[model samples]
Target: MSSASSSSVSAAAPASDWSAARIAEAAAEIVAGEQLPAIVQAGHPVLRTRAVAFDGQLDAELLDALLTIMRRTMHEAPGVGLAAPQIGLPLRLAVLEDTWAADEEIAHTRSREPLPFVAMVNPAYIPVGDGRAEFFEGCLSVRGYTAVVRRPDRVEARWSAPDGAARAAEFRGWQARIVQHETDHLGGTLYLDKAEARSLCANEEYSARWAQSTPEHAARALGF
Candidate 1:
């Protein structure tokens, strides 16, 4: 199977950096149409429920499979992040990547640096300071629109690496928002739950208003 057209959907910067052939390879596997794990929606019984930790060894195959499914789901839904719980997996894991970058650059020949596509396992976030920003946020599970949400501008987090090593990192700006959004999913919360009452916007309106907002503004408007 040929890789799905990188042009047809948003992808992480790393995926954008992949050569057409490389994307084709991955897309072939995806286009063959493996069963999509269930994506739990808002008001679903399990979506509001917390997920369990992944207790087994962190082997390469497991990591690859998780990443593959994540990429596929993100492509199919054209979403920025996905959680195992959203897929009905009940595991405390999620993937977050920059789909917007792919949309912006797919037509160009220049290769950009890979955005670190995160595979967080049993992740935890610790806010570093009192700084807060609002950004527009959309969810794969919620579908159809985005909402203004406020979130910390920066965060310190600890997560298990694919190789099972614990690592600590600091994130700010868009990266921070992405991490927070995916983390919320693992905890059985969606951005809709956190969005301020007046911030909700139809998908088209949010896109038109926020398509060019600064990272901070985007985060702020979304209530990140």
Candidate 2:
């Protein structure tokens, strides 16, 4: 598989230069309504740093405020999911929502459905089987591109709700994809790490060239 070229943002700075202060500044811009926080690019130190567990540190007021910000940020970025590290917060937290239901073709291809807004803390997932599904993926943190990533088709996740209640459920298809992707962020992992490098491309190029392709087609055409 050929490795995809890095986006300008991901290559703009060395990994070491992305300090917490920089992340804080970026985050403050969003919280203060100055501007939406720039999504931390893939090579930024924050994206690669392992996130800390929220545990019991977050009180009701803090958690509520954080959730509001995160949901707004996710919607502003127009992404289905957002993790804490993506906005410079190294906490095991993520928000996701997919208001639109998949069309018949897409539903048949990936079994995706609309998802309500969700906030998860300290989320972890386990693969259900050897079954795997591959699809094009993009990230707010990575920016400007997408790549084919093969992931477990189903997963059982354990997480905490805002009220400190334990939650566990099995997710399949695109739902599983969203959970796995967000949880990976907490562990300092990115889909690029597991992507078919040759299949990566700029968003425009992907839409023009491979948007209609399926996992089997991608494997045949891109050698993933």
Best by lDDT: 2
For residue 31, model 1's alpha carbon misses the true position, in angstroms, by 14
lDDT comparing candidate 2 with the true structure: 0.73
Instruction: Score candidate 1 by TM-score against the native.
Output: 0.70
Tell me, by TM-score, which candidate is best. Answer: 2
Tens digits of lDDT, candidate 1, 4-68: 11001112111112233433344344334558555667767556656555555334675567667
Worst 10 residues of 1 by lDDT: 1-10
Residues 1-224 of candidate 2: C-alpha lDDT, one tens digit per residue? 01111001222222334444544454455566655666688777777767666765455766767778988888877788888888877767888787654557867787687778888988888889899988888888888888888889989988888888998888888888888888887777788887899888788887677766375665678776
Task: Count clashes in each candidate, considering only residues at least 3 apart in sequence or on different chains.
Answer: 22, 1
